[model samples]
Each structure stands twice: as C-alpha cells, then as structure tokens.
Target: MIDTEILGWRAALVGELDHRRLKAPSVKLRSAQGAADGEAIYCVDLRVRHPNADHYLTSTELHSVEHFLLEGFMRLLPAHFVSVGIMGCQTGFYLAFRNEGRAGRLCDTLEQILAAIEHAREVPYANIEQCGNYRNHSLADAQRVAREILARRADWLDAA
Candidate 1:
C-alpha cells in the first residue's frame, strides 16, 4: 500500500501543474512512492505540449528527443537518474528518478540538458545497430523543440 504521507506529497507535486501558464514543455510530477530499500522514487511527465493541444511531437522528433534526453540525463545525473521513455501520446516523455527531493535542481539540470539539445549537431546512437528505426530521427526538429521548452523554463516548476 502507498503511504498516506507519500500520497500527500504526490498531490502537492501534481498541484504544481495547476499553476502553469504554458501547458506544453512543462514537467508534472505524476507519482511518488517509498521503496522497500528506503528510497523515494519519483515519476514525472515531461509534457512536450498540453495534452489537449492539437499537435504532438512527430515520430522523428520524439525519437530524437528521447535519445537526447536519455543520454543527457544519464550523463548529468547518473546517481539519481533512473530512465526516460517516450509517451504513447507522442506529447512528451516519462522521467523517473530516485531520491531526488529538490525540484529546483531538477529544473536546472533539465534546462542544461535542453540547452545541450538546442546545440546538438547529431542524435546519439542513431546507427542501424543502435536504434530500431534509425532513419526516423531529426536533429533539427529536436533542436527546435528543445528551444521551445527552454523558452518556458520558468513554467517548469511552480513558485516556492
């Protein structure tokens, strides 16, 4: 069973999204739980655009962004990093982490990652053997989306 206290924290985390002006490219805490090993696990939805928005990330853009994000987080936060996976809706990604309490720090690291993506010249691991659909990736589209997300960094987290 999930702890009551943890549920409250989850509520608070989800509440942060209520205050966001720009719905797209924002991070929303989806769930949090305490592990048997005494660690807190956080699952966040990295919304590329509002769920209700008319457009979504193209397959190529999503694939490229997924590659960049996975590589970037692994490089930047290996200690706390868990994994990043593309959303089925093609609107964003799901980011998981362990024992990370500071939303501000996450935001900072995300901005850095996005900045790197903005300037990235190539998508990581796009080779035939490395990726299933290697041909369906675009560095330019990924860069464009990264810039859009960076522009709304302030909306990534709620006011403390």
Candidate 2:
C-alpha cells in the first residue's frame, strides 16, 4: 500500500519545501508559511479521512505509526534535520530541518523516510522496539495501518 500517487503528492509537497532557496539558522518544521529564521522550515499537513467515523485505523494504530515514523526517521535521517512530530489532526506527520545544504534534498529525505516506513512494516513486533511516547500499540498493527493509510492516501488527502 502506501499510495504511490498520494505519496507522489506528498513528495511534491516536500519538493515545494525543498525548492525554496532559504537562508541559514533555518526553521525545521513549522505550522505555517513565512520565515522565522533565514533557514527553511518544512510544513507538514496530515489529514485523516473518516477519522472516528470509521473503524479503520484505530487511535492506537495511528499513534503507533506516528511514533514509529518519528523514531525511524530519527534513526535514519541526517542529524541536520530537526523537529519531528505528528500533526494535531491525527492524519499525517510533520518534519522540519535547517536546510544547511540545499532545498530539494527534502524530496530524497522523504523518499528515504517512506522507504523506511515500508521496510519497517516488514519487521515483526517482537523484533521492533518502542521509542515514542505511547507503547500500547504493536508493530503488526502499525504495519497494517500504514498499508491501509498509504493505500487510501488519495482519499485521505482529497478528504483534506
């Protein structure tokens, strides 16, 4: 799952962030547009479709993916990137970094992040460890939910 189409849109959003030629002391993740610092801040918006309306990805599953994605990125992405958290909307993730290098890099970074998410789905709960605030969710459920979310990404994003 992990809708390639919607993923592409997400990547484009990342690309839009990356395309900006920003200055240093950059903002990482921000809730809105405009410069806080010379550095560029990446804005993320996650919109969950039919949240609480359907029994698809339970609250536990969504939070699990949020934690897993953050933990996975922390372990995988370059240290230059900072600020990682789930959107308050409980739909997607947010990541911001001080673009010390370039802009378009966020696209590649996001690709890597997405790939890690897909790979993480393959890991068994017994093998994966908890690294986020909540620990009640399992890797299996996380993977399942990730697949569902990604598969329905268009519907999710369109719902936004």
Candidate 3:
C-alpha cells in the first residue's frame, strides 16, 4: 500500500520547511541508538518566519499554537489522535502521526482543511485552571501561521 506518486506531507514539510538543523548549518544530529531507522511515525514541523530570524515567540504564544493545532488536528482526524507540540525554538510545532501509511491521504485532506481556515481566532486549551500555563495563547500568531501555511502549501503541501 505504498504510494509511488506521493512523497508524503511529513517528508515534504521536512524537505521544504525551514528546518533548524538546516538553518544552523553547523549542528549535526546524533543518535544514542547508533544510527537506526529512528521512527515509525510521520513527523512534520511547521514554522513561521518573522521579519527578523531573531524574533521568536513568547511561551504563551507557543502554547496557543500548540493548542490550536492539537484541537484542529484532533478534530480533523478524529479516527486517530494527533500529537502537536512546540519546537524548542518556539517558531513552530512538531506533528507526529502514528499512521504513517496514511500520510498521502492526510496530505490531501490537510490541504483542503488548511485552505479553508481563513482566519483562525482561538486557542483550544487556554484554561487558567485547566491548562498548566494558561493565558499564553495568541490567536493572532496562530492565524498568521495558518494563513502562511496555506499560502506555502503550493510549495510544501503537495504529496508529489
């Protein structure tokens, strides 16, 4: 059931997005397992660019972005849960999907979903008492990134 035409969104995003490892140019990733296949899941990191590369996000903002995707993806792919978490740089999120075989199918669905999210205005789990660190959500940044991802989809989203 492997797809020959689709490169998969995880790989495409990893190939197209501004990866930190690639950005640094000097750092190299090592393995404790001594160079294994690494993972069975599909992982994609989504990033946003500010005018200055130095411009990073606040904790709350990162929280918002994480929560937004956590909610969106969970709802979008209800058959399976989606793990959406923030990158260490606070510029993006890491999405891990256990159903690796569905990457191509998900990519097609994601393009349609992302294309429809015109202006996102809410962070999913922004509860002061319920969430570990609340009030750290930014609908503005989330919306910006959503729009950005949609616009960049033509470059990074296609499965081919």
Candidate 4:
C-alpha cells in the first residue's frame, strides 16, 4: 500500500506553489505510486511560474518546448520515460516516468534535457506529419525558456 501522508509531505515540500506570486523555474516530484514487481510510477511538475501568476507561455513556445522535452526525455531515458506534457495553465510541464528505485537523479536528468534543448537547432517532431499544430512552434522561444530554466539549476531541488 502507498503512504498517503508521505506523499502529501513530498508534494508540500517539493511541489506546492504559492498561488499569489511568481516563482523561478523548478522541478518538483508531485506524485509517486508503486506498481507491480517493485516498480514505481512518478509524476513530476516542472514549473516556470507560480500557479496564480498572470504570465504564461505562448502556445508556440509551449509547443516547441514540448516537442524538445518529449523527444529529449525519450532519448535519454527510453526505458523509464512515460510522457512529457504541457500544463493546462501553461506555466510549465508534467513529466512522468516508471522506474524501480528512487528517482534521485531526476533533476540532473532534467538539466541535461534542458541543456540539449538550449543547444538544439530545431524542435524535434515539429513537422506537419508529426504534430497537430506543427506550424505553431518556435525553436528560439524554446531555447530561451530552456536557458531560463537552466539558470535556476541550483534551486530545482529546493524544498518549499
């Protein structure tokens, strides 16, 4: 069985966002559940802003970043990766993974992904054949956001 209290504590410490203000880029573990054979499924929130912040990502920027992040995560952790998706609020992303052990290296892995995005020449899979809104993407915007997130590397693991 899963420990609800522990999960709550983890979310409060690492994922809770102050709704009244803006926040720097951060990666937080939002949830984790055990699966069969001792494996676990984890969902992480990658925030670029606080929940109530008026600012949000443009659709183009979001699409570009999503393309890069989805491709990057898959390339880096193919066996463990589940999905990468944009938040409905447009403040950040949700990254899911399935693994057998503690995901202590998730922050490092995200850093690597962001770094690759920063240097990427194009947003992966942003073609008409691969995306629903293929024309709505901006590699430059994605790189800019990646840089912003990477700049906050030291704070990615900070507790709330």
Is candidate 3 or 4 superior in lDDT?
4
**Clash count, predicted structure 2:** 7
lDDT of 3 at 142: 61
Runs of candidate 3 with Cα error greater than 4 angstroms are: 1-40, 50-52, 101-104, 108-121, 157-160
Candidate 2's residue-wise lDDT over 19-126, tens digit each? 123222121222333355654444543433333433344566666666665665566565755665654545445565543223335444544554456666443232
lDDT of each: 0.77, 0.45, 0.52, 0.75
Which of the numbered candidates is closest to the native, going by highest TM-score? Answer: 4
lDDT per residue as tens, model 1, 11-68: 4556335523436767777776777888888787788876656688898989999999
TM-score of each: 0.84, 0.51, 0.63, 0.85
Model 1 lowest lDDT segment of ten: 1-10
- For residues 1-160, what per-residue lDDT tens digits would candidate 4 score against the true structure? 5553443334354444564533558766777778668878877878876666677888888889888888888887889989988999988888898871233567777788889886688889988899998889888999999998888888775534
Higher-ranked by lDDT: 1 or 4: 1
Model 3 TM-score, all chains together = 0.63
How many clashing pairs in candidate 1? 0
> Model 4, which residues run further than 4 Å from truth?
1-22, 100-103
**Which is the leading candidate under lDDT?**
1
